[model samples]
Target: MKTIALTVATAALGTDAFADSSLPGMTGTDHVGFTVPSVDEAVTFSQDVIGCNVFYPLGPFSGGDSTWMADHLNVDAKAEIPTMQLVRCGYGANFEIFEYTAPDQDTKLPRNSDIGGHHIAFYTTDMDGAVSYLQDKGIEVLGNPTTMTDGPSAGETWVYFLAPWGMQLELVSYPDGKAYEAEYDERLWDPRP
Candidate 1:
């Protein structure tokens, strides 16, 4: 795969994008945390099904029965995270899965269009092979992958699917990189070596 580099002058991103003063200037992602109904099952799916490695053992944690917990996590102060475990997701972000129990926690899974409805997209080198593998494993692989026809993201392929728990997930692949990356000094999806 080939990647193109561009002059910084031509790549006109606003300075405000780098002006976050809260955490000693923003760096790359550390991890992505999400609550699951069962930490053990989530761990199994992540490791055995999704090919992530369990970086650590599950452990119990709580944010304490105070306004701080509720205000920050949007869960009841008395919420109890019975277990949590971290997993390394290939070359990208880590996953922080938790099994939480709270009086006000909603059991319904949210759709992508709903508020706070989100899906974690995993990058792959082979979109068709990945989709086929997932389908062979009896995973609910959604329809065929869609290739972008135009725009900055042109040349990438992606598809959406669901986990056993109904949480939406996505797979993305761009072996040749994207159109916008050619006009920027840095890249969001760097070509694999």
Candidate 2:
């Protein structure tokens, strides 16, 4: 797998790269998908804690007597999806949360340094208020909010926290914008409205 990934990465670094060759008509990220332990608990945490709106529910899908699951989703052939949901926090992309049951499933949550480690960051205008809110709710905040003092992210303040189910999340604020905005006209995608 590492060799295959290296080959693909090497190929991508070649000079054939061009703006026009990118996915046609692609706009931006639509949603991020992940499998959770429980859909009900995830929905509650997303809505009550993270301030997300639960859009809808889906699934209870299984490919019985077929290889559809493995062929399409690259999961175990006998895997079953009991519940799934779509949620939107504020202004950026939505989240597709799934609850799956499989024979070979690994329930361990990966750390940020692990191969598939990931975290969701939400934007806010008030860093102090946001951090206080999380703390008041009995959430396990990793550390005090940090304000970048140098480089491109000089004006940004951020902090990391953990969900009840151990998913890593972050709250970031850059109300006056970052230092990089002064150096370049192009900007990273801003979730703030």
TM-score for each model: 0.82, 0.88
List per-prediction Cα lDDT, in the order shown.
0.80, 0.88
| Highest lDDT scorer | 2
Candidate 1 local lDDT, 1-193, one digit each (tens): 1212322422455455555547675744778998888888888888888899898856666777567668887778888778889998777678889888888889999998999899999888888889988898788978889999799999889999888888899999888788898788766745344
lDDT of 2 by residue, 96-169 (tens): 99999999999999999999999999998888888899999998999899999899999999999999999999
Please state every model's RMSD to the true fold in angstroms: 5.2, 8.9
lDDT of 1: 0.80
Error of 1 at 135 (Å): 0.7
Query: What are the clashing pairs of model 1?
Result: none
lDDT of 2 at 31: 97
State, as a TM-score between 0 and 1, how close model 1 is to the true structure: 0.82
